[model samples]
Target chain A: MEKKIRVLVAKPGLDGHDRGAKIVARALRDAGMEVIYTGLHQTAEMVVETAIQEDVDVVGLSLLSGAHMTLFVDVARLIKKKGLDDVLIIGGGIIPEEDISKLHKEGIAGVFGPGTPCEDIIKFIKENVKR
Target chain B: MKDIAKKVLSGDSRAIARLITLAENNDPSANDSMKDIHPHTGKAHVIGITGVMGSGKSTLIYELTRLYRKQGKTVGIIAIDPTSPFSGGALLGDRVRMMELTMDEGVFIRSMGTRGMLGGLASAVYDVVEILDASGKDVVIVETVGVGQAEVDIIKIADTTLVIIVPGLGDSIQTLKAGVMEIADIYVVNKADRAGVEQTVAEVESLVDITCSEKERKTPILSTIAKHGEGVKELIIEIENHEKYLKKTKEFETKRRLRYEAELIEIIRKRLMNFIFDEEQFKDKVELLIDQISKKQIDPHSAAEEILSKILK
Candidate 1:
């Protein structure tokens, strides 16, 4: 059976805005991937544990809260510590191009910023997820 | 299943954590692990705590977990958060609020991202809950992202659901109108000392009065200042009372049955969808349908019908 790619979409930090997160969740659902939207104000530990528990193929972090550097890195580190390097870790929201390279270095597979289409994310996961 | 289940039952943290990951990821080995662990579950009391952002839910859980540890009980917490859509990255900052409990030998805290699942919980949460139960945790806490309607999903999985509401927010009561109020087994008016505590309590009481019947148990509304650890013991007592009520009324069995039924349906639906998508001929047909739909040659309804007919054959 061709399993549906399960994605865990999380908003870390104190960022309350979730319009983008919800839209991405809907888009992924539309694309036939099972998506779990962890609501606002999560921590790195919470996101990693969710990714682990949900058995998701991808962990997508949406951080509009400028605290992306610390939160994203922490999540990536935790995932690694837990030996979940196989789970694709991606980020979206307000991340600067300069920070993108740094985040990728920190184990984030991809970074999608403002104006990136949902299809792009769906396609990226389809290509990158290691089954 | 045998080896892993034995390790989990013996309180092997690594095995427990690894199994939880496998289960969450829907790994092929997870079903076997679950089957081995299923009978060992049902001993742990599952509690779900949820509220709006900044309600100090983590601090409360931390304190409560400490209390449980003092009594020599193992605790597992699942904190759910939302994921960023554009970046495909997450912040997962809830664990910071729970840092104190992480290193505690008696406490196991796992943070989960909402990962686009609307119900403030992952589908694997029920499985995780069972794993924790089987792992000898006397109590398990599932903390939701607390974003109003989505938090209601906790009701389906929790043995006791606590809705934490803090005072001083001008429209906090009004915000708790829909899915939030209906699903609460007990409401904790946390941050009670901050201000407007009486008003918040009164508002919740009135709402509860309107929603609950006289024959049904009234959802006890407790006041707590979670930051200062005030009124926590009382809140715990209320939770215990709710649990006792559930067991006495046989509601626990009914709820578990419903959860199992839902789980069964969800698994079947997922498997069937996978089977459909896996068929090579069906994939080609779907591609053709997509092309036709893209070119406006056929409507989605017709495409769906065509696919269904092919599946039926």
Candidate 2:
């Protein structure tokens, strides 16, 4: 059987609101991918460990906590340290357009802010996930 | 089974950690590894611990894990936290409470975010539990992010579910009544050194008495100062007793059967949905339907029907 793409949707930092994360998780699941949602208040280490343990093809981070600059970079660095550069790292949240360049430079494949469609995120992942 | 699976079963921590990461990422190699290790599963006792935020659930799990380790048993801990909705990043801070066990050879701890799942438990948790079981861990403890409805999801995945409560959290019983109280196989009054321990214990007892049937076993409420590791041994005994009860009543087999059934259905649903949506021809149709729905030209129900009919035809 062809394996399903596994995506770990993580909420990093102190942000407690998860309505958007849940929506994206369901959307990814509906799109025929296995989504492992790490509930609220996750650290970079926990996210990296989960990504490793779940062996997900992609790690989608939803950080509305405005700690995106620090949290996202930490996660990206950890993934590389763990030899998971092959795992596509994508993010969404209240990220400002100015930060997108820096995030991309940090090895994040894509960044979706508020109002980005779930389909767009899914499409981006589908195209990028290494089969 | 991949070579990593064999190494993990043999208690190679590095391999186990690497394989867990692979599984978390849903790496294709993970499936091969799991297949190799599947036969070695079913030995570990799976226990799930959950409660509301600030309830000291992590402290309780940390305490409980120590007791298990004292007996020379290997343990696997899965700590589930919440993911941010907007940024999709996670902090996973629960490991802080478990720092003491970091160097313990008998303990392997992995913290998982709820990712985007509303429930405290992640979908891959079941698979991870199985992986830990196959790795020869005598016990696997899953700690959930302490939210209300999401905590209930823990019950479905755990053989023994412990709901931890702290005192001074106004009407803790009332909050429990919302969902978690009913699913708890064992209740822990954690942070017992704090005020309101007696009140919390009394409330739980009364609730248990009112809700538990005469034929159903009484739910034992234990008090623990998890931070100081007090009363942990008694909690372990209670857990073992629950295990024994399940075994003696033949409930163990029934629970396993139900778990397998749920898993099978979930897999089928996922596969069918993927097959329907991933079809190349359906892609453009889906995109067009989404666009129409977004434009308010058509309702979602009708669009879904159109898609289904095309598949049916």
Candidate 3:
């Protein structure tokens, strides 16, 4: 049987805004991948733990709280720290253009800013999955 | 693969999680590791929780896990959601209700999609339960995809099966007609704060009276506001009491024996079917027979009999 790609769509930080997370999750599902959405108010530790437990090929973090620089980096770094280097990390929501490269340095493979199409995210995951 | 079983026996979280994935994907290599870990299983109490959508099954499991954790019991949770037939994908949102348990080292939570399996469960659930059991969890909770009256397969896997109901969905005459209601070892009327708790409890009580034989244990029904954790302690006590009953009556061993029998039969069935269908030559021959049947030249039964004779020969 072909392996099904599993993605964790997590909302990190105190932000109650999860519409983007849900939208991305649904789009990923429609595109043929299992998506585990961890709803709003998730910590970095929570997201990384969820990623590990779910054995996801991708960890897509969404935060509209403007704490992406801290929250997304923390989650990416923690996932790496837990020896999950193969997990493809991605982030979205209110990210400035300058922080994109910085996030890349922190191991976030992709960053989708506002208005980025969901197809791009889906395609990126399908292309980048490891094992 | 040998080392994977070693790591799983040592309760390595990542190893346990990855092994479960390999099993779910039906990788043939997982069978070796499963054989290695087989003796380490049968220790964890497998609890199955099922209910209709919005009946607070997740919330009740959360509370139950919390109480179990208080007593220092390790837990493994598998929350199943439906896989979409159209896209072959699923949105598993059970983690939304279980995020807090992730931080606990003693708790392992995994979300699963049914992935075209019927009976309100993922196809790999039996293997997942054994994996968790070998990982040293004292308790394993299998929460089925939200179901109506027909998803009664949980009884075959769970040592104890909980059927969660809530007040005000409909009266007993509407929802309690068959299959699922008869399968419960325990019934929980969750969301007891709702308006129809009394009637709901009464309905289940009457049904239990009508269905339970005089020689059998009467299934207990309890009411709970699971969100607020009301009446949960009593619920756990009742579960323990039922466990005691099962052991005392030797039904525990009988249930386990029956489960293993069913599991062995299912494994052989799958392996046999896979072996037969996976050969291209055989499949092509079968397709030819199917074409003949479709053309009304050969009957389906005759074609099957010819195939069976060839296989036997």
Q: Candidate 2, residues A27-85: lDDT per residue as tens digits?
A: 87667665766577777887877676556689999888798999999999999998886
CA lDDT, candidate 1, residue B42 = 90
Q: Please provide, for model 2 over B85-191, each residue's C-alpha lDDT reduced to its tens digit, 9 standing for 90 to 100.
A: 65454545576687566556678877665655676776567778877888789999998887764458776678898888888777744845567777888999898
CAPRI docking class of candidate 3:
high
Off by over 4 Å in 3: B276-279, B282-313
Error of 1 at B158 (Å): 0.5
TM-score of each: 0.70, 0.70, 0.95
lDDT of 1 by residue, A20-58 (tens): 988887888667666766677777887776665456789
Chain A, model 3: TM:
0.97
Report the TM-score measured on chain A for model 2: 0.97
**What is the C-alpha local distance difference test score of each model?**
0.79, 0.80, 0.89
Write candidate 3's Cα lDDT for A48-119 as tens digits: 888888999999998888899899989988887888978999899999889999999999999999999999
Residue B177 in candidate 2 has what lDDT?
A: 53
What does DockQ come to for candidate 2? 0.07
DockQ of all candidate complexes: 0.07, 0.07, 0.86
Q: Per-residue lDDT tens digits of candidate 1, residues B89-118?
A: 444456556655644667776655554467
DockQ of the two-chain complex in candidate 1: 0.07
